[model samples]
Target: MSTVVAQTEEPEFDLVEAALALCGGDAHATITALLDELRFVRGQLALSEAGMSVGFTRGWKPRFEIEGDT
Candidate 1:
């Protein structure tokens, strides 16, 4: 009888560890930076959606609309 064995490979580098290293091992700073980047990306997406014509977008509505933005 033959037995099957499973092998798992680990990543060469950890992305979270790399980010912490880039932030000088400061977890708070890394989280803050990530949140800032997320906000910037969301703002850019909102702007792009706003600039698109209704006809071009096929009446698609943005999911991130803020109150008083319409």
Candidate 2:
């Protein structure tokens, strides 16, 4: 019997494809830079229609809402 190796799964960011498209196949400048670009791309997405429902949309709000308005 032979052993199999596992591979990593892709990120779940719906707008990731857009960021990659913006990159246009350029070599990643840096890990931080790539993340920065992605963040910018995410913000752009939030401005677009249905963007909030896409993948993961970040919103500023209080942590852990109080139930029953208590």
Candidate 3:
């Protein structure tokens, strides 16, 4: 009989726990600051994974411009 080795996979990071770590025991501050940072980081990572195709650019301009009648 041959024995097979089992491989173990690591668990994913919990946003709440990471946020708590950043909070340093302050509930309100943690919620606002940590959450904001988490959101920004998540957005950046998502965009990078998507090849950054959906965001805005500085040089983009509308083809038609509206003018007020005098």
Candidate 4:
């Protein structure tokens, strides 16, 4: 039986395709920026609607609430 050789062709990076990809990338970045803005705006809106404010001291709070060792 003859052994088959694998072809090693260089991957094509079309400039037009790459440019289109960058446009999509820009759109994705814009969406992410808008999402972050929305998160901040929605958080502010929620706080305003609830009419609640919280103050924090310059320290870290413990996340571990150990009831007992199992």
Which candidate number maximizes lDDT?
Answer: 1
> What would the per-residue lDDT of candidate 2 be over residues 16-53, giving only the tens digit for each residue?
56655666745474445687867887666556635444
Model 4 clash pairs? none
Q: List ranges where model 2 is wrong by over 4 Å.
A: 1-29, 50-70
lDDT string for model 4 (9-70, tens) is 99987865565465575866656666787788777766654553343423433322346797
- Candidate rank order under TM-score: 1, 4, 3, 2
Compare candidates 3 and 4 on TM-score and give the better one. 4
On TM-score, the candidate that comes out on top is: 1
Better of 2 and 3 by lDDT: 3
- Where model 3 places Cα greater than 4 Å from the true spot, the runs are 1-6, 34-70
Q: Candidate 4: TM-score?
A: 0.37
lDDT of each: 0.88, 0.59, 0.68, 0.61
Off by over 4 Å in 4: 1-25, 52-70
TM-score of each: 0.58, 0.30, 0.35, 0.37
